[model samples]
Target: DNIRLSIFVPIRDGLCNWKLQMVCKTDNIPDKERTAVFELNEGVLGYTFLKTRKHQIEFIDVSNNNNLPSTYVSLNSDNSNLINRDIKGVLVVSAFQNGSVAGLLAIDTENVSDLSKMEDNKLHSDALDWIIARSKAVKWIWRIKNNV
Candidate 1:
């Protein structure tokens, strides 16, 4: 069985602070089919494939409401008849508020017989890159504004 990984990045501001959200997902199907398995609650949302052999998918949302984090939700289950019996999909929903994001990540694990091969370092590195890029871009914008 093989799975795919994906990462989503979102940028927004609320009140006086900037917020960034990154969602990661893993699955063994196409994005269109994968999307039909999960739902998002607020802000902006999107998905993409990141890798194979343990698919990962991500949903990201950004907002200004400090209390929005409590409203985040996720639901996941396996559909054996949809595809190969060994292929499974996972859904993750995350919310951010007051410069923070919180949410749930769920996986359809009926088909997965083992969890000993999962590696998440790449995902962390990708997230780090996203934050660094955003920081640099924001700083550049501020520099330009101060000069003007």
Candidate 2:
């Protein structure tokens, strides 16, 4: 299993737009970092909610800064980046109900090479597909739990 952590971000209607509240993180994440509140169209979380995209998630590993795209990267300051350096692969998908997005589901890994397993056509890993499939369940849980 290449997955080190999986997180569910519930999208709620804010004053102007939607808000991406990060929660339901696996044990690996520090409790302090797990309660972050992110806005729509902020870093990787933003890309998943783009209007032009479909209900699919792709595995992306950009541990190397050189390979990371400028669009996906977020800066808190001129020199600070939000994404952790230890993170490797990441995939995100939006969960929907009645054609409205309800939540976001994401999976990530610390092993950079493990993410490339499916890439190399060497190992059979459904981790990416699994996250996409489980997205529906994520939405179901969020709706019931948060009464959204």
Candidate 3:
């Protein structure tokens, strides 16, 4: 089994905010996390956001190390229990709209083999590609043109 976690962090002039947009295969996520907000430079999520490509979509496996990576440390004191422990791989990709990076997406998978097998399956791989393509086509209309 694999955990599908999608994160979207908007890059703005003010405090960068990270949110847990969606999740699959897990229901025990604390309510706070579902509505949790994090500064862009604050946790593994922020780190991924800042490190991703600015314009083009790029996929990166942040961690594949067998041991726990120190980067998994949570910024929230309440989450001191360790949020992403034993995370085998983290897929980070850029999202764009109108030639600008709208957000960054990160998926954490505990079982890398499961993901690999899925990637090998044509249908699954096509679905994954569709998701990536869709990410790059994001259209952010929340901001007024020229901040009018």
Question: For model 1, how does the per-residue alpha-carbon lDDT over 1-148 read when each residue is reduced to its tens digit?
Answer: 3434433333334355332232444654444433332333332222322111122334322212342235444223432233234333333332222342322233332233323222245543454454344543434443343342
Candidate 1 Cα errors over 4 Å, as ranges: 9-28, 34-98, 102-114, 119-148
What is the full ranking by TM-score, best candidate first? 2, 3, 1
Residues 44-118, candidate 3: write the lDDT tens digits.
555555554543332324344334345543457644343555555555555555554455555566676655533
Best by TM-score: 2
Ranked by lDDT from best down, the candidates are: 2, 3, 1
My TM-score estimates for the predictions, one after another, are 0.27, 0.68, 0.51
Which residues of candidate 2, in runs, are more than 4 Å off?
73-83, 118-137, 144-147
